[model samples]
Target: MGFDADTGRLDVTPESPAYGTKLRWSAPKLIEAANTTVRGANMRTLNVLSPAPGKAGPATAAAAPDPRPTMPVGPVHTRAPASDGYHQALAAHQATRPERHVDPTIAQAIEAQTHALRELSRRAFPDPDPDSIENTRAKRRRDAKATHAQALRRARAERAQRGSTAAGVQAPSDRRTA
Candidate 1:
């Protein structure tokens, strides 16, 4: 569309894209017409993937940048590589390799290590015992009984020494009692 001298509005359409896009109408010197076409193409492809919040239409001026990349877009193209037989020759070449040697001692050691690890894993990491506390309590009780018996023997020996000093006396036979 041409300029509206009375309203001062530049009414634009798609065919007149070469004249200038939305950004050029607002800031004429900001970008060129070729740059605007690439940007338009980028927007079209990008919109196919993650779309805008509301892509039903595009705004004349956006507050944020579009999903379109800041780089130039081009058509996909590839050239058939000139073959020099490099890969084919390498594939046909024979490699000089050696056989794997297994030492009997080292093999036995590895086998033993594997078996030990297997046995360790087969057992529970934390063994569950029904009377774990009872075992500890029994050991403590035995220790206490031995200590009490020793104390009693010492006491009887002291008494006998005192009696022998006054008269003739001997300590009683040791008896384990608890």
Candidate 2:
């Protein structure tokens, strides 16, 4: 059944009196109907005969015999084969064509440059192999750890320098007492 354009629903209705009246043909019934129609048409028929037996029965008959007389067979016309001169000319032309060759040094240099570019690209944007949420988290953790470590080292160095400077300076009270 076709769909309704306005309601966007199938044409079938459960409440209709002929809702289930329409019967669908089974596979066997559909096949039988097709065979009957083909037989009625009297077209080509299958011939299951072995030439080795030599005594094979007549071919299957058409549903309707054709009354037209068969046409007489005539000799088939074909062009003569090519002469040897044509093939020789083609070979000579192919032999006269020059072959192109690349210098080995130039080819090697090109290959090396391509490899270098690929290596630089790989280093600039390293492959994120096995990309996953855990990998991303791990990378973030490593970056944070390195940043914290650098900050800690810088703070310690500044603190050590200040401690040394403070130790060199004597209090005014201590000077007076001296």
- Clashing residue pairs in all predictions, respectively, total 0, 0
| Superposition-based RMSD of candidate 2 using all C-alpha atoms, in angstroms | 19.6
TM-score of 2: 0.29
Best prediction by TM-score: 1
User: Against the correct fold, how does model 1 do in TM-score?
Assistant: 0.31
Instruction: State residue 150's C-alpha deviation in candidate 1, in Å.
Output: 2.7
lDDT of 2 by residue, 107-177 (tens): 99999999999999999878667675678889999999999998888787667666876999533442211
Residue 5, model 1: lDDT of 44
Give the per-residue lDDT of model 1 (tens digit) for 1-178. 3444444344444423443344445444332333375453212110011222433434534544597877648755587665669666655563434557999999999999999997887685544565866887899999999999999987886766778767855544563343
lDDT of each: 0.56, 0.57
> Please, what is the TM-score per model?
0.31, 0.29
Which candidate has the highest lDDT of all? 2
Candidate 1, pairs of clashing residues = none
